[model samples]
Target: MKRLSDHTDVQLTELFTLGDIDAFEEIYNRYWLKLYSAAYKRIKERATAQEIVQDFFTSFWINREQVKIQTSLQGYLFTSIKYLVLNYKRAQAVRNSYAEILLMVNNSFDNSTEENYNYKELLERVETEVNQLPPKCRNVFELSRKQYKTNKEIAQLMGISEKTVENHLTKALRYLRVNLNSLLLLTFLFLRR
Candidate 1:
């Protein structure tokens, strides 16, 4: 009865790479719970933590044949867990977007002064950023924002291909990201203020 914990990480990886299923099982058994605990500590949600750890193992198993262990197994395992935790955090970002979009959607009729102010602030910041775009990007962003034009519609209006219009919009967004941080902070402060 060999103890999985007693085996060197290199030996475990080598054994796994040699198509030994039991050796791979041993590797998984040794690390899965430990990895799960690491994830759980960050997220405090069992389902998300479970999903993260599960994805980590899935990636490792899927690439087991070609998997090269350049670092120690502990390093590789922890690195995978870190990526999974980051992904889990990112997916939850939609919660903020959805809440803002919902406020924008609902404020149309209720006409609360606060909500209306927030909507106007969001629009003003967006407009300011859009105005600062280069000519081509400004034109494309305007068609899409003011006219509610689809990418195809905007492309046709500009006599450019849809791909070109998409590229312009992409660049426009990149520019806004670079330029709009202060405006975004002001807008957020106004909404919360």
Candidate 2:
């Protein structure tokens, strides 16, 4: 009898779908390293890449019976990793944004006296800068931040392409970051005197 590891991918996939633990193990052994390497290359973090690969295998086994691989198992696995990487990056972007805002707030508090740390005035300054953005860019930025709409939703509401919406957002953020940093620096200098 051939070893489970010696079985062709088609045979292994068939056995896996039928809840054969050995077949599943064989598949894992065959693909885990390749999948990890691919993920690591894209994610550039060892721990995250390992976790992504582990999650893929865990889900594969859990949903074994329902998995419908129309193409080769290898193709399906690679496609799954691609989407997993995309999701990880999207989630990371959101986390990074929150972290940046938190750091900015913390630093501002550290550098200013109670009298100088006026949150309402800071918010008003931000609103003033946001209002100075070009008309369409300001609308896009407001829809995204104030209304909490997604890029896709903003694009639909404004009748613009998603890429255009993204560009407007990027431009707005760059402008705000530059302007706000300058304002903060000036405030710090004034407070020191």
* Candidate of highest lDDT: 2
What value does the lDDT take at residue 129 in candidate 2? 92
Model 2 spans > 4 angstroms off: 109-111, 115-193
Supply candidate 1's per-residue lDDT for 90. 46
**What's the lDDT for all of these models?**
0.72, 0.82
- lDDT (tens digit, per residue) of candidate 1 on 1-193: 3556677778888887887676777888888899989999998999878877886677677778888888898888888798768654643443344346446445442477877776676667767777878888899867765676766467668899655876776676667666765666665566555
Off by over 4 Å in 1: 1-6, 111-193
CA RMSD of all predictions: 10.1, 8.4
Q: What does the lDDT read for residue 103 in candidate 1? A: 62
Q: Can you write out model 2's per-residue Cα lDDT over 1-193, one digit (the tens) per residue? A: 3379769999999999999999899999999999999999999999989988997899899999899999999999999998878866764564366358647755655544563556557778989999999999999988877887766578789999656877787788778888888777776576566
- Model 2 scores a C-alpha lDDT of 0.82
Q: For model 2, name the residue pairs that clash.
A: none
